[model samples]
Target: MDLECSDLFEWHMQSGHGKVYADSFALFISIPLASLCVLILIS
Candidate 1:
């Protein structure tokens, strides 16, 4: 199990840093919209 996990992790790390930027962009946009919806519901 440990070996499998390590292999998977290595494969993921090799995939490149582009995914990190894309994920961060999605998170940045989603967090504010999610918070706004929550605030509207509370009000």
Candidate 2:
């Protein structure tokens, strides 16, 4: 039972990390795209 609980905890932690990584990647991509759009509008 304890081992199962630990495994579940680890799985949740990994999933949380994945979500954070994906969010960071999306933000990185969006910031560059937004900057490009702004530059195009200015020019």
Candidate 3:
């Protein structure tokens, strides 16, 4: 049971990191697109 818990914790940590990275990448892409949209609207 201890080993299982440890494995689960490690998996969760890895998945959490991946989720954070994906969120960051999405935000990075979105900022440029958002700026472009704002510019278009202004024009």
Q: Which candidate is the best by TM-score?
A: 2
What pairs collide in candidate 2?
none
Please, what are the lDDT tens digits per residue for candidate 2 over residues 1-43?
Answer: 9999888766855885867766788899999999999999999
Better structure of 1 and 3 per lDDT: 1
| Candidate 1 lDDT, 1-43, residue by residue in tens | 9999888767766789757856888899999999999999999
Clash count, predicted structure 2: 0
Q: How close is candidate 3 to the true structure, as a TM-score?
A: 0.61
Q: After superposition, how far is residue 41 of candidate 2 from its true place, in Å?
A: 0.4
Q: Candidate 2 at 31: error in angstroms?
A: 0.5
How many clashes show up per model? 0, 0, 0
Question: Least accurate stretch of 10 residues (summed lDDT) in model 1?
Answer: 9-18
Residue ranges of candidate 1 with Cα displaced over 4 Å? 1-15
lDDT for 32 (candidate 3) = 100
The digit string of per-residue lDDT tens for model 3 on 1-43 reads: 9999888766855885867766788899999999999999999
Predictions in order: lDDT:
0.84, 0.84, 0.84
User: Which structure among the candidates has the greatest lDDT?
Assistant: 1
